[model samples]
Target: MAVSHLPRTSGRLAIIAGAGALPHHVAEAARRQGEDPFIIALSREADADWSGFDHATLAIGDFAAISKAFAAEGIDRVVLSGAVRRRPDWRDIRPTLKTLAKVPSVLRTLVSGGDDAVLRMAMDLIEASGARVIGAHEVVPGLLADIGPIGEHTSTDDDLRDIEAGIAAANALGTLDVGQGAVAIGGRVVALEGAEGTDAMLARVAELKADGRVSSRRRGVLVKLCKPQQDERADLPSIGPSTVAGAEAAGLAGIAVEAGRALVLERPAVIETANRSGLFVLGIERNARERPR
Candidate 1:
């Protein structure tokens, strides 16, 4: 997969704005690649004036309005970035009639698990709209995290055992779309992320560790990975400085993520924080053999 060979938008344009810093980074990368990346700020989500890009505007769920904005600016490619809170709470996702028709099938796909169903539907809609959906990394090639453990400490034998255990549990749990992260201590499941999210799971792990009931030999280990059928183009698992903080608060010994399958936000800061806190932040490849017990 040639990740960096994005079709040249030499005289072309793009909408490089969304919910997270990834969109902002994508915009900058696009400009560096010689395309004038227009910015689209979601209501209360993105920074319109970020890095003084081409143009910016706030859209609140009006897909027609978004299309109009792109067409008016002659944007040929749309680079979606950041994470939009999913439906029900998706205040900014005003789907057109065409998109609405997809709602039922999309919901079914979501229910079936993984991100593919929704992303494929979205891609179809985007293509139907005459705009191409390109990977955000197409503009920013360096965002991909290198394979292997990426922190101050490598996984100890016990840590590896716990990690293996966490992987098994995470993968199995992911199949149910329950959560993508798990915390294990001494090869025993301490916590699993659910509707409460990773931070809450960390807190739960801390509470368990402090309870003096379980015989966990150490603090905890955090493992975050996407479901086997997750969409690579959308909703990829992400980690950043906040993740490190959460792990620290939970007394976790390390954090592991799927290499090349997850996003590392604020990489330098995340690594520095993990190093300072003595937390091991490693990237592991997801394979059937790596599942935890």
Candidate 2:
């Protein structure tokens, strides 16, 4: 497995954790690289157990506390990882002087925009606190999806049609900043991910299949790609073992994600699960524009 390298920066790194294992993976990778990361685990949003690490639990909108922690810890580089379940309520925010002026804009985006806009607002606030924001893949390069199959199975010719359809649908869905994933069966799009996310979308596919709304004889493919104007530093499309299980339950024949532009959490486990379930897990080229004939 070839891994990309990110330029190493001096000073302490902070993991602004949300919900999922990605933050923990980054922290472990940092430790292997001989750095002790200060974890800022978001309360309620972060479900991981942080007992072994030096960490602070704070609310998502507690900018005042986050800024103070950044200053005290001398954090120079920060990685925002995992999922935030909901937008912060106005009453929950405790903004510092530096972020006070931007609170209204943040709230506006949170109310009226997509996840990408909200993340940009959060990143702006993080930078205002004097810390540079970096992608989780920068901290753990091996997490990036490589070009080609990472599992035992490869996509069949029939699967290629679904993959192409999925890629097109995903890009169209992304253009609206709605979501990054889509499911296609028999060269027809069956679902487009929304705020409910990939898992929920897959669950819906399963329901549709059970209700005989979608073709059960011809299994589909789930494709996750980076949004058309996505910030690669945060929220690159991600997949894991759970993704494999979801695809399996949804009767998918394979899964595809944008190579180098997507994150594959627990690659070995993801591949193993996909292989066990006889599903192809492929990493297509990032700028895959040519449709399969």
Identify the runs in model 2 with alpha carbons over 4 angstroms from their true place: 1-4, 101-104, 286-293
lDDT of 2: 0.88
Candidate 1 ranges beyond 4 A from true positions: 10-20, 29-35, 44-51, 54-60, 86-94, 97-116, 211-217, 288-293
Q: What TM-score, to 2 decimals, does candidate 1 have?
A: 0.81
Q: What is the C-alpha RMSD of each candidate to the true structure, in Å?
A: 3.9, 2.3
Residues 151-261, model 2: lDDT tens digits = 989888889889989988898889899889999999999999988889999999999999999979989999999997998889999999999999999999989999888
CA lDDT of each prediction against the hidden true structure: 0.70, 0.88
* Model 1 / residue 279 / CA error / Å: 1.8
User: What's the count of clashing pairs in each model shown?
Assistant: 6, 0
Provide TM-scores for the models: 0.81, 0.94
- Over 12-101, each residue of candidate 1 has an lDDT whose tens digit, in order, gives 556535565667666776677777777667656565456586665656456667667767787777776775444322444566776667
